[model samples]
Structures are given as structure tokens and as C-alpha cells.
Target: MNARKVLLAEFLGTLLLLAIVVGSGIMGERLANGNAAIALLANAAATAGGLYVLIVLFGPISGAHFNPAVTLAMKLRGEALPASLAAMVCVQVAGAVLGVLLAHAMFDIALWQPGDHVRTGVAQWLSEGVATFGLLLTIVLGIRFRERAVPALVASYIFAAYWFTASTSFANPAVTLARSLTQTFAGIRPIDAPAFIAAQLVGAALAVLAARALLPAHSSVRR
Candidate 1:
């Protein structure tokens, strides 16, 4: 595929993904009558469904990697060029910010508010690391063993991660950053995003190493 087309796919995919995440959080919170559990359930369900569709729609064009961590993993695995990695990450972040703004506009909320949701602590950071590690492991293994099931596998894992992880699994750096701009159910405080991001990167790196060990480059599994 052409580079520009690939970049467009990443941008649009990330945009829609964030829109689904933030918009659902806003709607869920408003409708849940202060029941945080119900709001979180709705948010997780919407995000999982949207993510599956987005991956299926964009996979052929751009590999459907909306996360910077995933892009970095691809680069490490030699599946993406360095320039492509940088471009994809840039577009992903830009698209994520625009998505947050789009969600705010749909709900008639202030467009550029900084998030104040306090999601800091060692436990939350550890949760982020584990969540990201599992996510990357799922992607790598699914692609190698069941390429057609990647979308479903990822969506299901994220849905589960939302409930299991303390930080609700903000495993994507772009998502963590963009979400910090919205003070909603899905948002994380800007002050807390850096640690989450750092943990996520570490988790992704570990996953890559684990995947390589589980299935070396010479493995017979289809790439």
C-alpha cells in the first residue's frame, strides 16, 4: 500500500477509536445515574465493539495499529520502517486529540478542558504495565497463529482488561495523552499520564521479547 494511504488509515482509525472511547464514556456516565459500574461497563462494551470494527476495516490498509506501543513493536519486529513508525505515531496522536475534541463537540462540552481524574499510584502503574503486556502478547500471538482472529482477540482482551486493570487499561500512549484532555469517565489526569505511558512502553517491550522467545523468526507459523 502507498505510504500516504497507510498514514490516512492510521489517522482515521485512531480518530474513530478515541471518539468511541470518549463519547461512550460521556454518554454512559450521563445515563448511568451515578452508578460508576454501569458507566464503566457501557464504556468498555462500546470501546470493544468499535475497536473490533475499526481493526477489521483498517487492517488491510495500515495493519490497524492505532497505538504507538503497537507501532513500536512492529518496528522492533522489522515489520515497519523507522520513518513509517514515526509518521504513524504522529498521526495517531493527532487523530486521538481530534477525536477527543469531536466527542466533546457531540456532547456540547468544553472542547479543551484538562482532565482531573486522579489515576495515580504504584498499583495503577503496575496495572497499566500488565495490561499493555497482555495486549501486545495477544496481538503478536494472534497474528502468528490466528491472523483472521486478531480483531476479535484484541477486542475481547481489552474488554476484559477494562475490568481487571486498576487504571482501566490505558495501554496506548496516544490514548493516554489524548484522554488527559477530557475530564470525563475515560479521562486520566495529565499529571498521571507520563508514568502510565512509561509503564506501557516497558510492558510492550517485554511482550515483544516474550513473543520472540515463544515463536522465533524461524518458526513455521505464518507471518
Candidate 2:
């Protein structure tokens, strides 16, 4: 694909993913009001459905590395070309910012309250780690194995991660940054979000390194 096309793909893919996360969470919250279970289910459905659509939609154009962490990981293992890394990362992040800015226009949200910090601390951190790992693992296995399971793996991994991880697994960096802008049900406190994003980047990088080590050298080289 052309450079401009790839950049557009990343931009659009990220917006789509962010929209699902923010839009569904907001709608679910308003609908459920006091029902936590309903909210969680709605969030999970949005995550899974969002991923399924994104993977297919952008796979051809940019391989849909909607997260900066994922883009870095792919670049590490050479699965992604290095030439477009900077462009992709910048566009992806910008897309995320745009997505959340738009979300702000759509939602009724408030500025931070003191108690909000407490909710975002432990739960968000742990959830971020698990979500990052799941995302990395899905990419590693699906791409490495040449499995026809890429779509299914991504969807299922994200869905299961929501319940297993406390933070509901906000794995995408673009999503994280975009969310920080909302101050809504899906928002992440800006201060705390960076640390979680760092953890995610570390996890993704490690997974890429481990995946690289697993390949047979000769086979890897023959490509």
C-alpha cells in the first residue's frame, strides 16, 4: 500500500476502535445507570466487535497497528517496515486525540473529582498490563503461525481480557490517550494513563522479542 494510504488506514482504524470503546461505554452507562454487570457486558461487546471490524478493515492497508505499542513491536521483529513507523505512530496518536475530542462533543462529562483517582489507580494499572499482554500474544501467534485465526484471536482475546483484567483491558495506546480527553465513563486520568501505557509498551516489546527468538534461524532468514 502507499504511504498516504497506510497513514489514512491507521488514522481511520484508530478512530473506529476508540469510538467503539467510548461510545458503547457511554451508552451502556446511561442505559444501565446502576447496573454494573450490564455495563461490563456492553463494554466487552464493543471491544470485541470493534477489534473484529478494525482488523479486517485495515489489515490490507496498514496491518492495523492501531496502538503505538503494537507498531513498535512489529517494527522490532521486522514484521512491519521501518520506513513508515514514524508516520504511522504520529497519525495513529493524532487520530486518537481527534476521536476523544469528538467524543467530548457527544457526551455529558465532568471534570475530575477527588475520588476518581482511587478508582483509576489499582484497577487501571493491572487491567492495562493484562490487556497489553493479550494484544501482544494475539499478534505474535497469529502472525507468526500464519494462522487464519487472526480475526478470531484478536476478538476473543480482547473479550476475555475485559473480564479477566481489572481495568477492562484498554490495550490500545491511542484508545488510552483518546480516553484521557473524555472525562466520561471511558476516560482515563491523564496523569495515571502514561504509566499504564509504558507498562503496555514494555509488555508488547518483550512479547515481540520472545516471538523473534522462537523462530528457526534458517527459516527466518530464508524469507
Candidate 3:
């Protein structure tokens, strides 16, 4: 039953995240008057806001792991049960797909339009790695030092990464895959997902190692 609750939270939270990302991008594009920068700014702002709410709302239930990279990191850190990891990833991916479909429906677009957005390249891949690394690092340390600040810090990081990173910080594997199914401003080409996912996994692995060194599990001391 506990595992079930965790999975449910992961599913619902991931779904909401995708909806916010894709929906905001669509809305921003339509309202930006051909200014791509303006649209991206709007998209990033909404995503960050939605992300903060989702994390705060779901943190108690499942640690609010809306990203596969985060789930993997938690599992490695022993924060999530090993047996539950597979189920968590499965539900997150499923929820992400559903969120894309829902967003498309809401915007009156095709349900599964494969994106043609070219988002692959060395710089973008490297950006994804750095972005994911920062995210996992934040999660590990935030939970250790100031848990309440996590939502704000994470949202702020992602909002900033949208502009700082070449890939706009699609740091989550489930998110990357789902975004490939939409041709909206937030989408990535299906062909480019492998590189992005690979980069994210590598980044997350590195983060787990770094967090272990920087904020070891035994380092927490109550004040």
C-alpha cells in the first residue's frame, strides 16, 4: 500500500508537470507576437511556478520525484526502496505521456504529433548533463540542510537553466520522451531523445557520487 501511494504520487505529479510545460509553451507562443524569447520566458516562468507547487504538494507522499533522474538518484541514495524503483519509473513515463496528450487536447492539436524540433548537438547534450547534475545535487543537499527551501530552489534552478543551458534544461528522461511526442514549442525530435536521455543518466550518476561525497548520509546533525 505504501508503494502504491508512492506510485500514485509519482504518476499524478509527473502528469501535472508535463501539462504545465507543454501547455505553457503553447500559450506563450500564441501570445508572444513572434518573439521566441518572450515565449520562452513565459514558458519558463510557468513551469517553475507549477514545479514549485507540485513538489510541495507531493513531497510527503513520494518525495515528489517527477523526474526519472530524481527517482534513480533517490534509489541510489537509499531514500527510495530498490524494489519500488522500477514501478516508479514506469508510472512516471506513463504519466508523462498522458500529460502530453492532455495538453495537446486542451490546445486543440493532434494527440501525438511527433516533434521535428531539432534539439540534438554536442552543446545541447552537454547542457543536459550539467542541468541534470545540478538538479540532483540540489535535491540531495536540500533534503539534508533546508528541506523547505527545496521547492523554491529547484524551481528557480530550472527557470534559470532554461536560458543558461543550450537544451533549455530538459533534464528529466520521462519529460524528454513525452516532449518528443508533441510538436509544440517545448517538444524535441523523437530521434534526439536517446542522446538527451543518455546525457541525463550520466549526469544523474555523477550527481549521486558527488552528493555522497559532499553531503554524506551520516553528515546530518540536528541543531
Candidate 4:
């Protein structure tokens, strides 16, 4: 893919993802305040469903890797070029900030910070790892089984992981970092953000190895 095209795809994909995540998070928090479990589920469900559709529509254009993990895996598979990877990551992150900024225009996000502080400590770190693992696993396995159906399968897996996983499935590194920038319902504390991003990268890196060594050979996306 061309640099311009790759950048456009990344920007659009991330924008859509952030909108889905931030919007759903706000609604979930509003409805499930004092109900942490339900709130997380609601948000996770929204993210999964929204991503499923968006990835389907955009995957052909840019692989619909709204998450960095997906891009990393695709790159490792030789489906993605390093320049494109950098372009995608950069544009995606910028798009995330724009999405958040756009969201705050319509919604007073600060008022919705229900918790005195965001979730932190080992729980938060583990949540990042768990979320990233599930997300990367779904992407790798989905491609292994049905290359064309990967986008949809990823979306479905994310939706399911939302309720089943402990961390409510905040799997995207860019999303996590971007979330820290806002004080909204979807926000994570700035101090705690880097570890989560690092965890996601590590999870995705391992998934790449797994996809290479374990999955059946498929040249559809070479590595």
C-alpha cells in the first residue's frame, strides 16, 4: 500500500475505534455506576461489536488493524511493511487524540469520572496483559482459520473477551495511551499508562511468534 493510503486507513480506523470505545465507555459508566462489573461488560460489548463491523468494512484497505497488536502481527506475517507499520501506528495514535478531542466537544467527559481514581497496581497491569493476549490470540487464530473472515472473527472474540477477561479487555496500546489523556470514563491514569502499552506490545510480540511457529502455513500474508 502507498504511504498516503496507509496513513489514511490508520487514521480512519483509529478514529472510528476511539469513537466506539469512548462513546460506549461513557454510556456504560453512566448506566452502570456503582455497578463496576456491568459497566465493564457494557463497554466491552460495545467495543467488540463496533470493531467487528468497522474492521470488516476497512480491513481490505488497511487490514483494519485498529490495534497496534494486530498491525504488529500482520507485519510479522509479512502482510505489512515496516514503513506502513510506522505510518499506521503514528496515524492511528494521532487519530485517537482527535477522536477524544472531538468527543469532549459534545460531552463534558470530566464530570463522568465516577471513580475517585482510575484502576491501578497489579490488577491494572495484568488487565493490560490479559486484554492484549486475548486480542492477539483472536487475530492470529482468526487469520489461521479464515483469512477473509479475520475482521469479523476478531470483532466477535473481542466482544466475548470483554465479559470473560478480568481487565475488561482494553487491548489497544494506542487506545490505552490516548485514554490516559482524557479524564473521561474511558480514561486511564497517565502514570499507569506506559506499562499497559508495554504489556500490549509484549503480548502482541508473543502472538506473532505463536502465529509463526504453531499455525498452519498460509502464504496469504507472508512473513
Candidate 5:
């Protein structure tokens, strides 16, 4: 029952997260009159706001991990049970895909179209690494010092990261994969997902190690 609860929470949280991302991107693009900056602003703001609400709603049930990278970090940090990590990632990915489909359906777009958006190069990969690193770092520190503020902290960081990062900070592997299925403003070329996922893994691992070394030994937070 407990595992079921975790899975349900994760699935729902991830679904909502991706829906916000893709839906807002489409809406923003349609409304922005070809202004990339304005479209991005709407997308980022909606994502951040929706993410915060979802986390608050689901944190008690599944720790509100809508990202596979975040789940991996928790697993490595010994916060998440090894037996549960695989299930969590699976559900998150599935939920993400479903979310994209939902968004497309709402916007009357074709489902499962591959994205053509070309997000690549060394700089973009490096930005993904940095973005994931910061995200995990914030989670770890927030859990340890200010558990109550984690939702807001994470949302705010992501909102800023969208503007600062070259690739707009798709810090979650599941999100990167799902977004590849869409041809919207939030989409990334399918070919680019692998590198982004790789960067996110590296970043998550680094954040786990850093947190282990820096945080107090007896901290209450698991990850």
C-alpha cells in the first residue's frame, strides 16, 4: 500500500508537471506573436508555479519527485530505497509521456510527433549538467535546513534556470524524453535527449557526493 501510494503520487506529480510545461509552451507561443522571449517567459512562469503546487500536494506521499534524475540522486544518497528507485523512474517517465499527450490533445495537436527543435552542442550539454547540479544541490540543502521552503526554492531556481541555461535546463531525464515527443515551444529534438540525460546523470551524481561531504552526518533528511 505504501509503495502504491508512492507510485501514484509520483505518476500524478510528473503528469501534472509535464502538462504544465508543454501546455504553457504551446499557449505562450500562440499568444506571443513570434516573440521567443515572451513565449519563454510564459512557459517558465507556468512551469515554476505548477511545479510548486504539485510538490506541495504530493510531497508527503512520494517526496514529490517528478524527475528521474532526482530519484537517482535520492537513491545514491541512500534516501530512497534501492528496490523502489526503478519503479519510481519508470512511472515518472510514463507519466511524463502521458502528460505530453494530454497537452497535445488539449491544444488539438497531433499526438506523438517528433520534435524538430535543435538543442545541441557542448555548451547546451554543459548547461544541463550545471542546471541539474544546482537543482539537486538545492533539494539536498533545503531538505536539511529548511524543509518547509523546498517547494518554493526549487520552483524559483527552475524558473531562473530556464532563462540562464543554454538548453533551458531540462534537468530531468524523463522530461527530456517526453518533451522530445512534441514539436512545441518546449520540445527538444529527439536526437538531443540522450546527451541531456547523460549530463543530468553526471550532475545528479556530483550533487549527491557534494551533499554527502558537506551536510551534517546526522541530518534528518534521507537524501
Candidate 6:
């Protein structure tokens, strides 16, 4: 694949992903009439649906890895070159920021504001670790056994993770960073992002280790 095309695909995919996440959260909060559960449900549903479509659309181009953790996993697995990994991570972050700004524009909010939503503590960090672990595991296993279902698997997992995790499962590092720019329903405080990102990276690494043990490179499972 051409490097430029790969980068473009990643950029667009990540941009749209953040847009869906932040936009839906904003919309959901506004329309839910102060019902946090309903707002969350709407946010999760929109994010899941958008994620599925983005993956299906961009998977062929760049594997639709909108998340830096997913890109890191691919790099470690030798599925992605180091150069591409670096470029993808950079663009994914840039795109995520742009996506957040886009969402703010749509909602007529301040384009550059620090998020004040205070999310922290050991439980939240653990939840982030677990959420990211499950995400990477799902991607790796889904690709090994059911390549065509990767998008659906990821989307469904995220939707469920949103509800199950205390931090709302901000499994992507790019997303965690971008979300700190907003103060909406999906935003996380800037101070809280680093721990979440560290936990996510640890989780991703552990998932890769587990996947390697469960599914060796030489073992070929019938697809």
C-alpha cells in the first residue's frame, strides 16, 4: 500500500471516529433531558455504529486503526512497519484533535477548552487497563478466526465497554488526549489523561502477550 494512502485513510478514519464519539455525546446530553443513562446509551450506540462503518470503509486501506494502541499492537506483531506506525500514531492524534474541534463546531461550543471532568483513581485506571486489554484481544482474535467480523466485534466490544468500565472505556490513547480538549459528556480532565494512557499501553502490551500464547504464529486455524 502507498504510504500516503495509508496515512490518509488513518487520518480520515480517526477523525470521523472522534467526531462520532464527541458529537454523539454532546447531542445525547442535550437531548436526554438530564438523564445520564439515556445520554450514555445514545453516545454508546452512535459511537458503535460509526466505528463499525469506519472500520469497514477504511480497513482495506489502513486496517482502520484509529487507535494508537491498536497501531502499537500491530507494530509489535510485525503487521505494521516502524515508519508507518510512527506516522499513523502522529496522524491519528492530529486527526483526533481535529475531530474534537469539528464536534465543537457542530455543537456551537468553544473550540479550544480544557476539560474539567475529573476522572481518576485506581479503579478508573484498572478499568482502562481492562478495557484496552479486552479491545486488543478482541482485535487479534477476531482477525485470526473471523477476519470479516473484526469491525462488528470491535464495535460491539466498545459499546459494551462504555457501559461496563468506570471511565467509559477510553481505550484509545489518541481519543484520551483529544477528549481532554472538550468539557462535554465524553471529555476527560487533562490531568487524568496520562494515567489512563499509561494503563492503556500496559493493557495493550499484555493483550499481545496473551494472544501470542493462545495463538502461535505457526498455528493455522481454519477461517
* Per-model TM-score on C-alpha atoms: 0.97, 0.87, 0.96, 0.86, 0.96, 0.97
Candidate 2: regions farther than 4 A off: 107-123, 218-223
- Residues 88-130 of candidate 2 have per-residue lDDT tens digits of 8899899877766555456754422211322366566766876
- List candidate 6 stretches off by more than 4 Å: none
Clashing pairs in 2: none
Which sections of candidate 4 miss by over 4 Å? 109-117, 218-223
lDDT of 4 at 185: 67
| Residue range 1-223, candidate 5, lDDT tens digits | 3898899889999998999999999999999999999999999999999999999999988899899899888888777442388899999999999999999999999988999999999999999999999999999899898899999999999999999999998999999999999999999999989999999999999999899889888957633
Q: What's the distance in Å from true for residue 120, model 1?
A: 0.6
Tens-digit per-residue lDDT, 59-153, candidate 1: 99999999999999988887754337789999999999999999999999999999999999999999999999999999999998889999999
lDDT of each: 0.94, 0.75, 0.92, 0.73, 0.93, 0.94
Q: Higher lDDT: candidate 5 or 6?
A: 6
Worst 10 residues of 1 by lDDT: 77-86
- The whole-model C-alpha lDDT of candidate 2 against the native structure comes to 0.75
- Candidate 4 vs candidate 6: which has greater TM-score? 6
Pairs with backbone N, CA or C atoms under 3 Å apart (clashes), candidate 5: none
Better of 2 and 5 by TM-score: 5
Q: Evaluate model 3: give its TM-score.
A: 0.96
Can you write out model 3's per-residue Cα lDDT over 119-190, one digit (the tens) per residue?
988999999999999999987788788778999989999999999999999999999999999999999999
When summed lDDT is taken over every stretch of 10 residues in candidate 3, the lowest stretch is: 214-223
